[model samples]
Target: MSSKTLISVVGPTAIGKTRLAIILAKHFKTEIVSADSRQFFKEMHIGTAVPSAEELKAVPHHFIQHKSIFEPYSVGDFEKEAIAQIEKLFQNNDYVVMVGGSGLYVDAVVNGLDEFPQIDSKLRDSLNQKLEKEGLECLQEELLVLDPKYYHLVDIHNPHRVIRALEVCLTAKKPYSSFLNQKRKKRNFNSFYVGIQADREVIYERINQRVDIMIEAGLLDEAKKLYPHKNLNALQTVGYKELLEYFDKNFTLDFAISEIKKNTRRFAKRQLTWLRKNKNILWVDFNTEPKVILEKITNQLKTNPHA
Candidate 1:
């Protein structure tokens, strides 16, 4: 068995996942490969919550802010890129850290993605027209009816994710969830999952606080700068989406910020929902000290050396 292992640090947003990942990276003297799809765009910074400059310098990081909002990037593209980066890093270290709240991207790196049948472009275009005619919630409701399992797990606010799932469901005449985990492809390195969780109240509070901090840190100005490109796929994320709606004069600024907090809490709930389905991850309390968590991880590494 290969000794190399990828420690995937996953949790809801504002749960200190980056802190834990950095500690592990330092301990292993290794690098980190980010799987958060939102952090991939160069145009989005404060809204996506890219790591602080000091954090990036503390350890070498990859796949963060490496692309433009205009460039087309998908989970499949990320899976390929992350695997290649991990292979390169594994040449010098036995363990590398992968951290992100984006469960699909993290899972794609750990368990190879299921092969999706080719979706018809016209069908996708039709969905887009429907989205335009109605709104994001229209397609979100349709997806809930078609695939509740995925509907609960996905960011229903993301038009791309919702429409993509709908396209597959409509084409295959089955729940999009049914096609997942059909097979787990083999990889050269083992994977160990570490998840952090907190009480619901605690998680929501943190998310609310984080949103306020982002606002104070000039999130509105950043969103204003990207207002022209709000139609881009990368701008379809949570923090930026609500702000973009504000730019469209859909509501008051205060209401927009509140919506950001509300939507972010819902997003975190969905994140936990998707993450809890994986039985292999060793979940730790969000407030657990770094040394204690590190001790648990090291113990697992020693006990299950090959896994």
Candidate 2:
């Protein structure tokens, strides 16, 4: 490998990214910089499948459980911090591994993020009033009208996404689509993009089983502890938000669990869709034997040693 090569392993949740990243890091004798957004919060453990204790012991990790739930973290923040961390790691390690399921976070590290304009507090207050008075559905509709393209790509159920899109569209009198043209910013180091893939049935089965495991591991209790903060924009995630509905008596535990699996499946599909658009990704099907997959990556690294 060239000096300070960066390897990224990205995929849908439960596609074995954690295990594969650990193995790759061990093989390269390097450490990991996590791009998983949820795994960054110290209070959120079970819900976010953070590397198990043993895996963390096996390979050094950065950015895991490094923040409080209340902290205001953004993809831009992650981009800046992760780049700085990777620069430091490059001083010692040749190959730095980045692993996560969050497509936006990974993109932030690999490709520099856009420079969004400063938030207008008045516009935000008006949007917040609309959210409280007419509900997120109103903001969702507005976003769809203003930028149908982004509306289709964004998490439709996320109120924050809806509000932000509306804020830009209303204030700028333009589609949010204009700002998301995906211009690739230059990076200091070469990056090899690795993605994990599996059969759809296998992936869905794993997602369901993983949800069951999360519930058994006290995901409900964790949700209960953070129930008061559920309204926070950061807490509007798949596992916790579904459980918040259960706590509100809007759904049973069984139904909430079902919703979690369903939402996660849709999320996985979206993740794959996002990754497929990037031509740089080298896909490794997890269904194949580990030896075979490792050989593929090893061969690629040998052929293109610069990355």
Candidate 3:
């Protein structure tokens, strides 16, 4: 068994992963490494729903607001950087906490990223141009036709994912699903997954309320500030994209707010779907108190120290 263990806190958005991660880190006297993709971009703080100033002070965190929207980052880059960071942290502490709702990012750290054959740079550029010309719907449709299984599992609304799948199909002469199903590389440290779950209605309610709070905290202004860069991949997230439509006069404020809530609820559903497929996860219901949750982890850790 490895001496160092990684504790991952995963769940749908608004299920309190951040709060639970902080509590776990404090108990274990360790730091946190955020796996949230959106939170990596410094310009997207408000729309990304990053942890508050108090939360940051509670425990040191890595990978939060460390990148620019213009920078190109891949899961392979994240795997290298996050594993290096975790190794550095493990030199000081045996256990470290990682928290996020992004399945791809979390999977990258735990399972290692998949290796894809390199395509010509010109081919990639051509695909990107076609995406901009014909819109994401065209790319999404092609991805669905090439890799239905990945289409079902991936974030369909995510243009990057669609483009990536199309890239695999065009370059490899095989469906992207074929490569995705290949064996995942192993990791050095033991990973203990702690998942938080709630009833659908309850989870949806929390997502809706969180969106309302984000609006109250000036999400509109934040989106407006980035309106000029709405075409950037970083700004394609839920909170910003909807508000961008509002700026384009495509929708009223009320309509935009409703769409944010609706899309967030859908996102939560997708998160649950992704998490449930992982059998290694040990799930705890949200109805349990935080102290109770901590006790459960503590007891489990005592029995299985290497977990």
TM-score of each: 0.98, 0.94, 0.95
RMSD to the hidden true structure, all candidates? 0.9, 1.8, 1.6
Best model number under lDDT: 1
Clashes of each: 0, 0, 0
Q: Which regions in candidate 2 have their CA more than 4 angstroms from the true location?
A: 305-307
Question: Against the hidden true structure, what lDDT does model 3 obtain?
Answer: 0.88
1 or 3, which is superior by lDDT? Answer: 1
- Return the top candidate by TM-score: 1
lDDT of 3 by residue, 141-219 (tens): 8888888877887777777777888888889989887775357676768888999998899999998889889999999
Location of the lowest summed lDDT over 10 successive residues in candidate 1? 298-307
Candidate 3 at 147: error in angstroms? 1.3
Model 2: per-residue Cα lDDT at residue 102: 86
How many Å off is the CA of 95 in candidate 2? 0.6
Give candidate 2's TM-score: 0.94
lDDT of candidate 2 at residue 266, scale 0 to 100: 88
Off by over 4 Å in 3: 303-307
Instruction: Compose the digit string of candidate 1's lDDT tens values, residues 1-307.
Output: 8989999999999999999999999999999999999899988999989999999999999999999988999899999999999999999999999999999999899998997778999999999999899888889989999999899888888899899899999999999999997788899999999999999999999999999999999999999999998888888888988888899999789999999999999999999989988998899999888999999999988998655
* Whole-model lDDT, model 2: 0.86
